[model samples]
Target: MTPALLKVQGLRVAFGDKEVVHGIDFDIAPGEKLALVGESGSGKTVTALSLLRLVQNADISGTARFEHDKAGAAARDLLSLPERTLRGIRGKEIAMIFQEPMTALNALYAVGDQIAEVLELHQGLSAQAAHEAAVQLLADTGIPEPARRARAFPHQLSGGQRQRAMIAMALACKPRLLLADEPTTALDVTVRGQILDLLADLQRQHGMAVLLITHDLNLVRRFADRVAVMENGHLVEHGPVATVFGAPRHPYTRRLIDSRPTRDVAPVPVDPAALPVVAASGLRVIYPVPRPGIKGWFTKGEFVAVQGADFRIAPGQTLGVVGESGSGKSTLALAALGLLKHQGQLDVAGRQWAAGGASDRGLRRLMQVVFQDPFSSLSPRMTVEQIVGEGLTVHAPELDVRARRARSLAALADVGLTEDQFPALLERYPHEFSGGQRQRLAIARALIVEPKLLVLDEPTSALDVTIQKQVLGLLQRLQRERGLSYLLITHDVEVIRAMAHQVIVMKDGAILESGPVGRVLDAPVHPYTQKLVAAAAT
Candidate 1:
């Protein structure tokens, strides 16, 4: 049998006096796929970064031996390699695709140039030759209009296109091993599947191994041959994917396997005469796009983000909008929040928004929104008190400072945060808290206004599985306590099933199906809905 392509023995990663990745061991064979599964802060990313010595000032001690077939290139210790030698091997033989492609890529340069840079650096290709190769690579990754896209800057491409560009760069050199760190975590479900399939196809063609670092179990089931479960700093379980998932030996492994979101509660009937928290009829949202130089002066083109739509969210009920990226879910949320202009009728609490009037101000207090990615959504410079109380200032400017503080504290308490646990709760800034805590702070910020309807746009998409569960539970409790309404916008079918009573499946800014969660999820009639469910379940 062929020997392992890469072997890690007693790997440890440390920063100053703290050790985060304890001694761990694993191996990857040629043309193999191994998934490193764990929650946030579980040492998964650090472990992968340590291998390539990419962690800044991180003290990594381990024997990461890479096996090569060339002369004098038999097993060599990558951990002990000098800086220059490691740089030579980084993109040429061992490549890495970071989690966020947007930030990973250079904003100043076009994506094609980025790929050409790698080719020129490793293969010593000429300027023209590299340009040709780069365009080819883009085409290989399934990006349309390769030459045109290659000329486009990183920001010009969509999320999926940018990710595809990143993949094209990573595989430009035909590396022996690829380390993908949550490659699809930020992408939509359909795009995630496409990226995974692309990786699998590329791996087979290049005959390279993959070390995938992610918390997504479905990706592991579909892609990996072996799985390694990490908890805190330890490798709790390591074995074949089927074995580990079918009969996990470690308690942590079992918990991880069983962590998929489950239905929490059934919908209780509401009064027939009661009005919906939010209502939309024939909702159409259109944006003006730039036309070509000649046509620009005559007429601007229009991009319809949301087609004519109709839906109603009963008070105390969750209306879930599930779809891929660019689907009208977010657009619908924006329309419902009165942030964007729409053609059709949309009312909040039986009232239509009157732009910048007393009615609009009152509606703002009635309906608030919680955006995705708490870390970025929350202002870094603002203290907890200021962040939560800022809404109060806009809604109830007449209130005194002390009254606002009391209300803010009460709102924080409702979301399970208190001054008792965090003495500097009011004074502490966003950077001081963890991801989950930051989300809680966001929730408190939203609740401080006493909103009747909350437009939650992918609330738990950025959180870990366990943290997501906790946040969902907190939201559920808040709904029960306040009889609040929620417009949950997300791509995760599991989250929709768990939290939503009514579900709407959307594609290309159009609703494919809408009904009770169980009916749509369990027995989806539309092909798109069925595809989504199948992709999620596997």
Candidate 2:
């Protein structure tokens, strides 16, 4: 092991009169990879933010002594450093890679300009040199066509691309210690692996230490040398990754490690002879691409999103679509919902949507969708009652106000929301509830319309592991009770194992493999499925 690079001792952070991060201690040795693992609201992010005194308007009392790489140079306390001096060390010595790249990167400037700005400020490189270095950094991060991409704005690039640009900026000056806070949380499984691999490659090349903060235990197992678990502001466990994961000393640590998705009960068997609630065959979706200048006027090319896909979801069954970011899982969901124009046959509950509104009105009522992020899926301005009851107006417009109110209350109660438990439930807003509660509200809003098929696009991906299990259980129970079918689109193999009865592996806008959940996941023959399963197991 190398010598210590940074040591955090008696680290405490308080907001107002309440202490969120109790006194804790940890250390990162030279070129070491240390992971801080904990669930959301467990103070993992806060702890990482406090290392550089980045948290605003908070009481901080700690000694985060950072050993200068220079031989015999005295160690300085980062926590107690004066603002003027700390600014010099920020990007020049130690850099941070934020979680959400879209929010972190500048919207006004090109990606290359953003990276160049970092180099210009920290390394004092001229504009031309900094821009050249930024392009080289983007290429280093595995972003193909770096020259063109470096000129692209954050919104113009894909999610993975934006994240790579963020990494490029972080590594522009080659700092000694890198702080990554949930760096891969927003990425797909394959993309997450790519980012981690890139980090490992750069870490080896630069010989920099990494302090990773994430809740995913699997990531810690694969990437970290040592692990530390925090719960309710207290550091409960700290040891080598293998040692801590193999034998967690604290109950909280054990629970966090044990929270992986597991199949507790046998999945309910779907009758193969029964009619499918949702059916699609040779479904194809394509978007018209605009050509440059005068060529665009002559012809418009097409980009295929979902190509030649076929699947069926039986009544009271879950059909999981597993794939990476560009795999067209969500495209298939949109096609199934009649939200996009497609070239193949797709029927829902014996009927398909058509051009005529009068003809498609009945088919539209049979299917609904629950989106990925509950916060964005739900309307912030509306009250709980309004958000849930809005569906009733469209589906059962003949019903009077009194009957609609009654049905809305019943639907809310169905999803575990009751005025008895939550007083003023009808008046409460979505922001007032937790992530799990907001998802329940989303489910209620979808269920209030009594749709036979629910298109769930990464429904639990935004939640913590335990919360995901609870939500999946709730969805399963609802399916059993109401004979509802789900088209579950997600990248999580564990989630597919726990929820789906039938599974299909999608790649490059096509179905690579399709079979029973156990067969496809446990005994996958396709190389893509094999890779997904292997990654999940790790």
Candidate 3:
């Protein structure tokens, strides 16, 4: 039998006074694909980081033996490797693709420069050679116009492009092992499939073992050869992917699989009385793309983000837009809120607003938005009070500071946050709050506006399953009490089934189908929509 490429035993990690990961054992064979599945804070990422000695300010103890190519060789304990020696192994023998590409990449440096830096550090390549190789790597990762895009910074690329660039950088040196932590979390479904396919292709061509850490069970079931389940820092189960998925021994794993939204199950019907208070028609948004350099002075190209998409919402209704990444779901939401420059017909609170612009205070008064990442959206320097009250300051300036404070506290209560927690939460910054709390804070801020319509762009994507359920329930309750409408944009079909009354299926900036959530999801008319629903189901 072939020796394992990577063997980890009795692995444990602890921060000061707190143990995040208990002793766990696992192995990866040559060219094998292994998945670490768990909820947030489940030690999946910590375990992966521990393999590279990247766990900071923590006490890590374990045996991690890496057996290289030669049969007769000295086994290296990766946990005990010195920094310099570990650096040598980092990008050349082992590469890691982080969860958040935007933050993982440097904003100031060109994408090419970042990729080149990896080659220079590991392979000692010349700058010219590195740049040329970087372009090729980007192309290999399925990025378009690799030459031009290589020179662009992280901010210039879309979420999918940024993720691809990160993959290119990780694979530039052809590492023997790759650690991918939720690499497809931010990508649209189509782009996500492409990236996953690329990873599988590279694994085959290079015979590299992969450790994929993700909450997405669908991806794991499709791509992984072996599976390891973790819960609250413990390794609950590990086995062949088919064995574990088909006959899940762990209750947590079974719950996760069942929690995933499915077309097989019928959606519960929401009463018509609980419909959206606002609606839109023929929504369109076109962004101008400038040509290269001086050529842009006279030439321009238009990028249509949302094209003639129509939907409606009665009071307390949640309308979900489901599509792959870059399918213009968010663009449609922005257009609905009049936040993007678009040609569309929108009615909020029975008033015409899409004809006017987002800048119109009247339109702003009728709608609000809660973004995906609360850490970035909320002001890090400001207190929770400041963050929540900012909307009131803008839309209802006539309200006194005392009145705003009372309203903010009430909003917090509406979302299940207590006033007594205010002393600690109100004065504290965003980083102090947990992921769920931060998301609740975002919802509170949106609710403070008391708008008829709220645009939620992947609000629960970053959260764990339990937190997601809680947040979903909170939104439903708040809708019932406040009579608010929701325009939820997400790739999560399960969320749509749980909360949406109407569903809009979009692709390539156009609506493929739109109808009642139950009918469309149960009997999808469009092939693309059916694929999306199927992908989510398994």
lDDT for each of the candidates?
0.92, 0.89, 0.86
Top model number, TM-score: 1
Runs in model 3 lying further than 4 Å from the true structure:
124-132, 261-276, 291-301, 354-363, 392-406, 419-425
Question: Candidate 3 at 41: error in angstroms?
Answer: 1.7
Lowest summed lDDT over 10 consecutive residues: which window, candidate 3? 260-269
Report the C-alpha lDDT of model 3 over 395-448, residue by residue, as the tens digit. 889999999989988888889888586566567788888888999999999888
| Candidate 1 TM-score, C-alpha based | 0.97
Assess the local accuracy of residue 153 in candidate 2 as a C-alpha lDDT between 0 and 100: 93
lDDT of 1 at 344: 89
lDDT by residue for model 2 over 1-538, one digit each (tens)?
6668999999999999999999999999989999998777889899988888899999999899999868999999998789999998887789999999999998999999999999999888999999999999999999999999989999999889999998899899999999998889888888889898999999999999999999888899899999999988999899999899898889988887777676543455657787788888999999999988999999998999999898888777889999998899999998898889999898887777888576777777788889999999898999998999998887788988889888889998888889998999999999999898899999999998889989999998888877787888888778778888889999998888988888999998989999999999989999999999987776
How would the candidate models be sorted by lDDT, starting from the highest? 1, 2, 3
Winner by lDDT: 1
- What does each candidate score in C-alpha RMSD? 1.5, 2.0, 3.7
Q: Give the Å shift of residue 244 in candidate 2.
A: 1.4
lDDT of 2: 0.89
Q: Which stretches of candidate 2 lie over 4 Å from their true place?
A: 1-3, 264-273, 356-359, 398-402
TM-score of 2: 0.95
